[model samples]
Structures are given as C-alpha cells and as structure tokens.
Target: MSAEEVHNRISMLRAERGVSRKDLAAALGVHYQTIGYLERGEYSPSLFLALRIAEYFGVPVEVVFSLRPFPRLGSEVVK
Candidate 1:
C-alpha cells in the first residue's frame, strides 16, 4: 500500500471515547491543527507520537493505525 493509506487510529479512538481533538491536542502538547492534519491523512506522525496518541486513548497502537490495502485511485474504503 502507498503511504497515504496509513490510517490514523486517533480519530476512531477519539470518537469511541468522546474525546475532542482539542482535548487530545492538549494532552499531547500539540496544536489542534496537528490533530486535524493527522486525522485527515495530511500528516504522518512519528512512532513516538503514535505511541503517545494510543496511550492517551488507552488502546494498543495497532488498534488505531493499520496498513490498509491501497484502494483504486478513484475509489474509497468505507470504515
């Protein structure tokens, strides 16, 4: 899969926990934009950052991120 197919587990976990992006950002000591970027696939976080996010969400890292097979260019994958 192309790197863009790397999904951020943060969004899903946040939804599950009812945690807002702002709250996560505060916990991570980052700007809210950083969270938004990660959630939108516009940014790929470092391993350390990924671990931090997963820790904050009280989940294993793999639960949040996955190397999904790359979809066809004009198609999409539903969650």
Candidate 2:
C-alpha cells in the first residue's frame, strides 16, 4: 500500500511564534535540516516527533498535524 502524505502546520506555527528552524531543531533534538525537510513535506516526522512538536507549540497534535490538507487561514469564516 502507498503511504499517505502527512500534512502539518509546523512552518506556520514557527512563524507565529518567532521561532527559527535551528532553534526548533535544537529544542526537538533533531538536525536543523530536518526541520526544513518537514516544512517542505519532503520527510514525515515520527509519531513521537509529531507529539513533541505539538507540545512545543502548546497545542494539540491534531492542530499541528493532519492527514488531510488544512483549510486556508480565515477560510472557515463566512462573509
């Protein structure tokens, strides 16, 4: 079976929190380049890493990661 792509908001969260990739990587005990790979969807994080990322952002895992694509910002609001 083909592997499903895991979607994430790591980049957005990092931006909102004023975090640098190197800083985040250091916090997560991963290589800085790994953060770039994750942001680019070129690599998928392990479950443990995903949970750690969510914990770092003080948000639920679902908020940070999703199997389906997340809606654009403010797209849920009705005009």
Residue-by-residue lDDT tens digits, candidate 2, 1-79:
1267998999999999999999999999999999999998889899999999999999999999988888999987954
Per-residue lDDT of model 1, residues 1-79, tens digit only: 6745677667767888899989999999999999999988888888899889888878888877777733433575443
**Model 1 stretches with alpha carbons more than 4 Å out:** 69-79
lDDT of each: 0.80, 0.94
Evaluated against the true structure, the overall lDDT of model 2 is 0.94
Tell me how far the alpha carbon of residue 48 in candidate 2 is from the true structure, in angstroms, after superposition: 0.6
Best by TM-score: 2
> In model 2, where is the ten-residue run with the lowest total lDDT?
1-10
By summed lDDT, the worst window of 10 consecutive residues in model 1 runs over 70-79
Query: Roughly what TM-score does model 1 have, to 2 decimal places?
Result: 0.78
The local lDDT score (0 to 100) that residue 28 gets in candidate 1 is 97
List the candidates' TM-scores in order: 0.78, 0.92
Runs of candidate 2 with Cα error greater than 4 angstroms are none
The deviation in Å at residue 77 for candidate 1 is 17
